[model samples]
Target: MIENNRIKYSLAGFFMGVAELIPGISGATVAVIFKIYPNLMTILSKLRIKHLSFSLSSLSKKFQFDLLLPLIFSMIAAIILCSKAINFLLNNYEENFLTFLGCLMIILSLQIINFFKGILHQKKLFIFIFLGTSIGFILGQLDVESENISIFYLILSGVLAFSFFLIPGISGSSMLVVLGIYSPIIGAIANFNFDILIPFALGCLISLLLLPRLILSIYSSYEQSLLYLFSGLIASSGLLLL
Candidate 1:
């Protein structure tokens, strides 16, 4: 049973990783689709990166290695293997690709609403959904681009981009684009620029250390409202692509 679960999680991670590489899709969306969002949130929220020891025994005791290890490996493999094909598709057939993605996202949002079965008050639900949709549309309208990026901006980019990844519908790459740091970061990756990478990586670490816990806390306190918000945001993301 454990082995089977490991395989299942590994596959989930691979798909999530690949989805994140796409412009409109968030990895969290894939996590939701795979029914692993709760588990993913729980594990991430309790992450203890500062307490790491070099020993394998301590590592196993400190972390849920069975799940984490498979996710890490599978996601890494997917990023390494699938990026080029995704890029090719995006470059050549962006409209078609985004259309498909938009449809998928909207469908997922409807399913989430259906799951609630009208438990929420209509007015409150509509408000949350509208708020989320507005944010999504605003994000889609942004097209900031930059040539000169400072360490501070790099760090901020790292933090915001990673934070977006944790959100159900927001695209981390889109956040990067909004911050005008996406191109620079991509250039850094392609050219192996440590100056750009170190700060960005630090930002990601900061988000990992802080954002997950905060998200989990908010989610626990407002699961129903947040779900409505996320459903709306995801639907808007799809609309943007369309």
Candidate 2:
């Protein structure tokens, strides 16, 4: 049973990595599809100095080191390794690639709608949905040329991507594309360009470190609004893909 569970975890990591590779997919969305979204977010939230100390202690060592460590590390490794191949594919087959992404976004949007059914007040949420959709549509249409690498922008990307990770249906990768950082990051990985990678990595680390608490706070205080906003964002994102 333990061995089987390990295999399941590994498969989950692989799928999540694949999602991260795609320009319009999110690793967090893959986690949701696999029914492990909550667990992933919970683990990320616990990544702090106090949690590290607790994890090092004998009592928490088994849970932290044995299970969580392997799962998270494997996922990160898989994403890094798969990214190059995905970039190649995207470059070669842009149309087909985008079609697949559009379909996936549609499915995700439906899932968001189903998730909010019977709980949220639709009337109250529609306006937010409209606004989100408008913003997404406008953002999708605008294109920007890449600028010289900046540590500040890298950190900002991390924060924005991390926030998207917590939001259901919104793909962090898609957000990266809109912000014009997706290709550069992929290129850095493909070529082992540390000059571009180190700052981006730092940004991702900081954002992930800080995101959990913010997510938890929002979930605790404004659960309905959060869900509604996420649903809207997802719907808008799907439209953008189309």
> Residue by residue across 1-242, what tens digits does model 1's lDDT show?
98988888899899888988877788887777777777788788777757678898777656668987898899999999999998898899988988888898899987876735664546668888888899899888987766788899889889999998999887798788778777788899999999999999999999998888888888889877888888888999999888
C-alpha TM-score for every candidate: 0.91, 0.75
RMSD per model, one decimal: 2.1, 3.7
Stretches > 4 Å off in candidate 2: 1-11, 54-70, 73-93, 113-122
**How does candidate 1 fare on TM-score?**
0.91
Best by TM-score: 1
- In model 2, the worst 10-residue window by lDDT is 54-63
